[model samples]
Target chain A: MTTQASVAPLDRAPAPETPFFFPSGDRPLYAVHHAPVAGRANAPVVVHCHSLGVEQVTCYRAEVLCARAAAAAGFPVLRYHARGHGDSAGDFADATLARLIEDALAAAREALRRSGATHVIWLGVRFGALVAASALPLGPPAAGLALWEPVQSPRDYFRAQLRGLLYSQVAEGRKPTETVDDLFARLDRDGAVDVHGYYLHRALADSVRDVTLARRLETWNGPTFLAQIEQRRSLAPAHAALAEALAARGAKVETMRVPEEPGWHMVANPAWTSPELVAATAEWLRAVA
Target chain B: MPWRESAADLDRARAERPIVVPSAFGGLVGIYTPAAPDVPSAGLCAVLLTRPRSHRNRMWVEGARRLAAQGFACFRFDYHGTGDSEGPTGPLDPNRPYRDDIVTVLRVLRAQLGGRRFVLCGACFDARTALSAFADEADAIAGLMFMAAPVVELDTLVRVDADRKDWGHLARSLRNPYNWKSLASAGRWRYMATVIGRVARRSLGAAPAGDPPLGAAFVEHFQALLRSRARALFLYGRDDAEYESFRIAERTAFAKLTPEQRARLEVEVWDGTVHGFLEMKRQRETFERALGWIAALHPARAAAPARTIPGDATPSAVAG
Candidate 1:
């Protein structure tokens, strides 16, 4: 005389994250992949692209949280450091735009091979989104692309970084011996300029400054998800325009306006969590799956 | 000639042996061994880099790789709660007893590399950790290389607080006609006067060097190391005024030591660099310098069997 509830199935626990290294070129890229806990139909292998420099460090915890969420939601997740960044075997001073794109493509292929998902999805933030966009033509066809606060123009991004360098100098009460023009001149003359700690080399800088995502994504008609941060209720006007443009390109587009505090800027705090963004992204990914 | 050249160089030397050691608190420690060819004949000192408190061991990877490439075996590891290491954050404290973690890593590293000579390298709060760990196990280790270490007096700290590099920008801004026009306002004039007085007071050493909370006696710790004939390197950036304060305090401490003890310590400053040596060129330079210093301090005793021991050598010769 056994009760009906006595033999109920136990809830499946999420897979423990595994850290390993796989090669893109001669260099090994440090990667952490989380296998899906429960089997789901038509699941996409999610590959995360991290932003560069300090952002990469600060955003790591958030990335881990999101990756765990995706894994828990029954999606196989892969997050990796780009060439010359993080635990990867390369020098950051030598990283170029083309190289980053190639790395993204390599990562996608590897993720697909490892996860055996029906299709691949690219989830990236800041400069990482640009890498994902540029790799589209080279990589396996993506099932979906999710960009969080993607930079519209590389030139604008570079300019903003320069402004930040200037601001740091000014705040220190030290007059920069070289002006912005002088720095550009040095880059032209010597093929690189030391801005703060980063070396803005000729090849990387030229390629980055010339990248216009709007132009590159014009014909890319995939399922696109754009998450923009907003302090108030309405969507940012620029993000709305980008969404409209993508939708016009024959892709099913979804927009989510997350809270201003997205929790990816503090390296010291390992407990920082972005609940709204994580919930939104997980829900959207699950529905699509 | 191409951007890929550097990457190629790094890749060639990028062999890392990733190992996880069990810690005391039922947790695992993540350690990465640099891809260095082991030369047991050279008796090269192995370096154990401590984590810089909040920073997750990523900052020291480049330095470790560079050292390994130059013949020294380098190991970088995360403490209990940081990086990929497993542990609850509750039990991990930088100020409290963490010497067990350091000793465990060293013991495991010694077993793996089969090297007796060891050097502890750390920066910032990590420097404090290295110093404390060395103090506890001075008999086991050879030397230390500390960067931007906290070893400052109240006066030096105040002086560092007053120093600034904004004079060039300030002069240019003041000369601008637009600024003059704006300065006509009473509020602007008052603000300018306040700033000017503050800067002037700071520069003139009028600020009080009030008693502030001090950590462990850093000078005393170094003196102990020096007395034992253990070599030390204190590195700082010129732009980091706080480390400059440390430089001044450390020099004052050195004045009280005998020549033999003084000879065991070396202080270096890198110009046009920040505390972390964040710039690529400077970072490389720092690594090279550390390698050179290590070579000088702990030369292959096997190579020159009859050579005079560093401890027994003339103080002037050691300093030179």
Candidate 2:
């Protein structure tokens, strides 16, 4: 039989509000597909990618804002639940860049078919940004992407996710091994992160670890937005640095720092949550769409 | 490894039945009972309900609906540091800080009633909490009902005695950082109690009297609790897998009592019903049935004809 020998480009179709399901790991991938309620539907289709963990819930505020912004600006948006996410089925440990890309492609193709949106765009936050960068199809007739807090270094993102759970375990005074990598293989074998309940697997962890969004990014992808939050703590120098690189390669790069608010990664502080970020992204998508 | 979202499951869960239970330390940090009875009676006002480790609150609403149909206002609240009320799920505060709130609520209910015979009812451990804290000198609380009384069952880990699937959470929760550290000495009575509670649930059953001493009890001593203050009624469902065993074991041990011990005890069962009678629709119907059982125990105290009217009232209508 045929293995994963070649990339099968996705053929996705969209309906008024029907969720497009992509074949992901022996199950259909389902997502809530929202189109512009008001006008002709031939708008840019933006595949909105979501963040990881609790932040995923937190990011719903942003996703809704962005979708409305796009829909208002005549863009039909398709949001797909990645495998092991939402209605999509598969073990969480099986969540790799490959499935994520498959999920995005499936969603994007569906949006194109359903709305006749000629251009596809990628909009993401945090881990969503990293995945979008890692898996955005490489070719001509491509979609532009706008990312917020792309963990510039894969090492740092891995550290945050793994450490947040394991450290909580250790903080509870339970014995934890020296580092998360030590438990990664063991936990992956268990198909669970043991502490955090996130799916863990060798392949998925490797895909996440290997993604250095800055190095992987290039020009020709067209108008890129590298949104940052500044306070003395800039998450990754690589993010700003990548913007500079894309600009150097003749791609239009815009660096906008949300100066007054705390980073989305840290939400324990109630005041740090900025509804303004939601407002701005919505406005930005409206203008672009 | 990357974590995937449980979006569809959450959607289904939300659509089917939405419920929120904070962790031991979740929610607003306060325990509140219903306000003082001075507030104008709205003919069965809604009362905020809470109690310690309250799976029994499931039956409280069942009881509330019975009284509500007759236009009575009552509320059951969680203990200061227990259940859905707030501040730490367990590690039950020995000082019982929440007792003040319970006292305050009862006083308010007393003041509000203006001698209208306000009633207070509790299921499981809440009944014990009510009896200990707010049992006297009230125009309200004309009647007290304790369903599936907590005294006998509280002796065992709920995991062993109740239909609580949430026992897994308790078992995991008891592994709380504070509990683990306290048990380091391994010989302390406090440590023993903690260990016993956890191990009791983990073990299939058969916890001994000396097993870590969380107010350990003898079979003979437990029966003395049959004495009721305000014509107490004990109602349970026969179909409930958990209470069926609990009822059988309790009634057997209770039956062995002397005539004096048997006099104050009155028990009734709803055949083919689960703990809380969750399988039945129309919770009021289940409650009215229970009320009929309770009313039968005190023919003189009865307010209504002990009759249930079908198609006359819905749950929402009763909530008002």
Across residues A73-109, which tens digit of lDDT does each residue of candidate 1 receive? 7899898888777667776666788888878888888
Per-model TM-score versus the true fold: 0.74, 0.45
Task: Report fnat for all candidates as fractions from 0 to 1.
Answer: 0.13, 0.03
* Each model's chain A TM-score: 0.86, 0.76
In candidate 1, what are the lDDT values of residues B10-115, reduced to their tens digit? 6433566456666774333343544445533334445545432113324455555555655666666666545445444333233443566777777776687675
> Mind giving the per-residue lDDT tens digits that candidate 2 earns over B81-136?
33223332233321222335545555554464432343444443444444444333
lDDT of 1 at A84: 72
Positional deviation of B247 in candidate 2, in angstroms? 21
Q: Residue B137's C-alpha lDDT in candidate 2? A: 28
lDDT of each: 0.63, 0.47
lDDT of 1 at A260: 71
**Which residue window of length 10 is worst by lDDT in model 2 chain A?**
A1-10
Clashing pairs in 1: A173-B166, A174-B165, A174-B166
DockQ of 1: 0.20
